[model samples]
Target: SKMFYGGVKPEMVSDKFSFTEGPSTDKEGNVYFTDQPNDKIYYWDWKTNKVIEFLNKTGRANGTHFDKDDFLITCSDDQGEIWKISKDKKVEVLFKGFEGKRLNGPNDVWNDSFGGMYFTDPLYERDYWVDFKQETP
Candidate 1:
């Protein structure tokens, strides 16, 4: 048998959200993604083939990844924090800031086999901010 479904075509899953970003998958093949403008996270269940709201009021998360322990790690850009959401829907702040300064914004993340995580921080001025500049670090 072929390892992939060669004849499959791309299909639009959902169009109800504003903007989607940071899609990741768990060990069970369930796909998770975030809608940054709407502050929500959604999931595509592998068994049911349905897209459902996994989390709301998600701190304007832009990027996400599933850690080894099955926790949903998210870049909560609204507050410049990294969050971890568990299976039971509990949220925890994994990272807050650096040297008393707020992070620019976490854009994406990846986890290594050794339980280390790496992410990108980029500065982007948002409408909600009072006085912020986009700068390179």
Candidate 2:
């Protein structure tokens, strides 16, 4: 098979985390994942073969995807919003809500071929949202 990640088997980088989700890979083969319970995001560097903590205080980010600009887009569910993050660790809230109502909780995100985005808003409660309430149906 000369096509497609030929025989690329899943490799376990580590088993240290409270809870983990949202694994996204960059063009450079670096893998980024989230640990919501710990409010942290980690990345596995292809060059170094190491799992490095990329950021903390992640807003309980659940799912992540890379945008056309190579920005790491994440569903910052703790705020019921989406975030666009740069390589330098700069963050910007891209979307908050729709129709004047708060989102349920953006759990995942995916980018279209044309640079548009698609995401999932599921009602996944978090410990951080102390006064939490689902504003929309």
Candidate 3:
């Protein structure tokens, strides 16, 4: 069930790149979103109707989820790590690798009621990579 605010209009904040990925709301209904390209997290308060940077250098954080314990879980795409953000804003890496090699990139994630988490790896190419040479025929 999707909920809607009474009269809030979605307006552009700036020409800046938001690069927003997963958006998660807290128990207080405050929404948190990621700006992966710029490596920042933003917060949109329902009561204030404002967006503010919650964190910086988020490790290219992508998908975000909140656990039953109120900890913020984020899938960091840059380093392929899942993080647990405590209430005190302390971040800890919950997972770094699955087998041995680094994951491609955590594109999205979710948590089950049974305390299990699932994530996706879809980063096939680096954002800064450039193909300067073509295959020789």
Candidate 4:
């Protein structure tokens, strides 16, 4: 069991975030993750092996998956929406609600091969919300 990890001991990479969630890898092997309570996103550089802050004010993004085009598709749930974040840090809201009603929250996202996405709308309310209510049963 000594060689369980090739003798590599566990080391703390970074710390100091309210909560972390949703890690997705890019085409180049770098990993991106979120700190939802702090509204931030960070990535681990494949070449440098360093954690880098990718974005802030991320709308309480929880889960993420990369699209075919390398865009970081995110479940930005602050306002219950899905956002596609470009490499240049451009944010495009892909969805907001259903039937003109606000979604409870987008908790996760997955992209299909045919350029479509499937996401989860959970009613787990957040303190940052104004008046939490489930728009969908």
Q: Could you say which candidate leads in lDDT? A: 4
- Model 4 per-residue lDDT tens digits across residues 45-125: 979989999999998999999998999999988899899999999999987988998878899999987899899998887
TM-score of candidate 4 on Cα atoms, chains taken together:
0.89
Q: Clashing residue pairs in candidate 1, if any?
A: none
lDDT of each: 0.86, 0.89, 0.78, 0.90
**lDDT order of candidates, best first?**
4, 2, 1, 3
lDDT tens per residue, model 3, 1-137: 43558776667654555567899988899888898888888888879878877888888888998887778899886676789888667999988776665666777888877888888876556674244121211
Q: Is candidate 2 or candidate 3 better by lDDT?
A: 2
**Model 2, backbone clash pairs (residues 3+ apart or across chains), number:** 0
After superposition, candidate 3 runs with Cα above 4 Å error: 1-16, 128-137
Clashes of each: 0, 0, 0, 0
- Whole-model lDDT, candidate 1? 0.86
Model 4, stretches more than 4 Å misplaced? 1-10
My TM-score estimates for the predictions, one after another, are 0.89, 0.90, 0.80, 0.89
lDDT of 2 by residue, 34-101 (tens): 99888899999989989999999888888999998789999988879899999899999998998988
Q: For residues 6-94, could you state the per-residue lDDT of candidate 1 as single tens digits? A: 88867777788888999999999999999888889999997987999999998888999998898999998887789999988999998
Ranked by TM-score, the better of candidates 3 and 4 is 4
Error of 1 at 10 (Å): 1.0
